[model samples]
Each structure stands twice: as structure tokens, then as C-alpha cells.
Target chain A: MFGLIGRMRASPGKRDELVALLLDGTEAMPGCLSYVVARDPVDADTIWITEVWTDEQSHKASLDLPRVQATIAKARPIIAGFDSQTRTEPVGGVGL
Target chain B: MFGLIGRMRASPGKRDELVALLLDGTEAMPGCLSYVVARDPVDADTIWITEVWTDEQSHKASLDLPRVQATIAKARPIIAGFDSQTRTEPVGGVGL
Candidate 1:
């Protein structure tokens, strides 16, 4: 499995809105096993997104998807910057 | 629940060793729901550690555990530096 751990920083007061935007329409994507958008307890302006996909290609393909493209466009405005992003290979877990 | 997404970079050519160190003796931790250790596909020397604990306190308490502390000590040497660290509140998920 492929895993992505990314931290997105929002405009000073736009964290909640960004989280909601990220959550909307994330489901039903092909090969997506888990998609989680969570509130960062330490950083008020940050959101931690953890995703598990069947493979790296599936995740790459999803970006070209229209729904995702639109969501990304909507989120772009509120996003302040990306704090960090990392890619990983998920070996196994309870959720997998 | 509490979520932690941390990226640990290993010294040059030591990624695999670091991953093994992090994984050893991780199980049996109290209140730990899911713990995933993954290799960063994009970065050769980075490891992404994703964790879900019952609560913030449980996660904090785990650090003081003898086993965990020992693991930390073992891992400390090969560790390069933290790329990113973020704390999150997991709303709900298939795993939890």
C-alpha cells in the first residue's frame, strides 16, 4: 500500500474551512482504502492529511480526476502553504 | 483520538536499519490503535511514522514506557533529523 502524510497550513483563520473542503467528495475514489483529514492539535493553522491507497499510481491518477481537480482548485485559495509532505509504503495495519 | 504524523530522516544509507529499530517492540503499547512505519518513496532517507492512540495522554505516556524509551534510545543514533512533526485529532475512521 502507498501512504501519504502531508501537513497543510491554512490562512490564519481558515483551518476549519480547509479541512471541510479536503473531506468533501474524497470518498468513492478508485483504489483508495482510507482518507483521513484531521485537525492538528498543536498547530491551530495546520491540518494533517493521512491517506492510504492501493498503489502509488492510483494516487497519482486521482489527481487528474475532475472532482479532485476541482477540489484542489477550491482549496488553493485558503491554503497558506505546505509545511511538509512525505510519501511512504504502508506494509500493513489494522485498517488495511 | 490522537494522531501523530512524523517524518524521521536517517543518516545516509541507514534508512532500513532505522525502520527496523522503530518497528521492533512497538506492539503491546497501551491505547495504541494503529502504528504504521513506512518508507518514503520520494526521499531515500526518510521514514514516515503514522500513529493513532486512544488519546493525547496515552501517546504522551507511551514515550515514558521502558520499552518505548529503550527503542527511542536505540533509534536516536541513526536518526538524522525530523523533517516534520504534527499533532492531529482523528475524528473517526474505518480502523478505529
Candidate 2:
């Protein structure tokens, strides 16, 4: 399975808004197995997104979905910058 | 929910061993919702562990489990070092 783990920093005071937009955008992806949005416990403006997909191609294709594109456009303003990003190969786990 | 996201580096040529040990140790976790082990695509010796639990106490308590303790002891020798660790509050997601 393909996985992506990343840390994103929201614009000051907009973390919750950013998370809402992210969760709202997750409704209809075809190959997504798990998509989790979490808030940094200490850093209020930081968020972490963990995603598991059936394959790399599925994850890439999701970006072209109209809903995803719209969500990106809507969230762009509130997103400050991404801190770290890692692509992974999931072998086995509870969620998989 | 409580969440933990971290990156761990295994001893040279021991990444798969570490992954196997971790997966083996996952059974019987009481409040764990998800525990995913993924390998870094770019770095052969690195791993990312993403976990979601019902609460912080459940996570803390898990360390005392005999199986978990054994896994930790077994894995300690092959674990090179931990790179990053983050505590998170998981609000909503596909798995949880």
C-alpha cells in the first residue's frame, strides 16, 4: 500500500478551519483506505495528516478529483506551509 | 482520541526485522484503534509508526503489556534512533 505522512502548519489562528476543510474533502476517494487528520497537542497551529492508499497511482489520481481540487482551493489561504512530508510503503497493520 | 506519530530508524539492514517485531506485538492492545507501520520509500532504514488510541492513558498503559515489553526489549538492539515524535489529538477521520 502507498502511504503519505506529513506535517502541515496552518496560518495563525486558522488551524481548526484548515482541519475542517480537510475532513470535508475526504468523502469520496476511491482507493483511500485511511485518512486521518490530527492536531499537534503542543503547537496549536500545526496539523498532521496520515493517509493510506491502495497504491501510489490512486493517491495521485485523487488530486484531479473535482472535490479535492475545490477543497485545495478553499484551504490554500489558511494553510501556511508544510513542515515535513514522507512517502511510505505500508506493509501491514491494523488499519490496512 | 490520542495519537502518536513518529519516525524511527533501524540498525543497518534491520528494517524488516523491526517491522516484523512491531506487527507481532500489536495484538491484544485494548484501546488501540489503529497502528500502522510503514517503511520510508527513500530511506531503507527508516520507519514511520502512526497510532491512534481511545485515550492517552490507554496508550501509556499499553507499555506495561508483557507482549509490548518483550517487543520493545527485542527491538531496542536494532533500533538506531528515533528521529521525530509528535503527540496529537485526532478529531475525526476515516478509521476513527
Candidate DockQ values, in order, are: 0.40, 0.79
Tell me the interface RMSD of model 1, in angstroms: 2.4
Worst 10 residues of 2 chain B by lDDT: B87-96
- Which sections of candidate 2 miss by over 4 Å? none
TM-score of each prediction? 0.72, 0.94
Compose the digit string of candidate 2's lDDT tens values, residues A37-77: 99998998999999999999999999999999999999999
Off by over 4 Å in 1: A9-14, A28-30, A61-84, A92-95
Tens-digit lDDT string for candidate 1 (A1-96): 988887789999998888877777475678887677788777889887888889989999999888889989999999999987767797655345
Interface RMSD of each: 2.4, 1.0
lDDT of each: 0.81, 0.92
Instruction: Give the alpha carbon lDDT tens digit for every residue of B4-47 in model 1.
Output: 88878999999988888777747678898778788888788988
Q: How good is model 1 by TM-score?
A: 0.72
Best candidate, TM-score: 2
TM-score of 2: 0.94
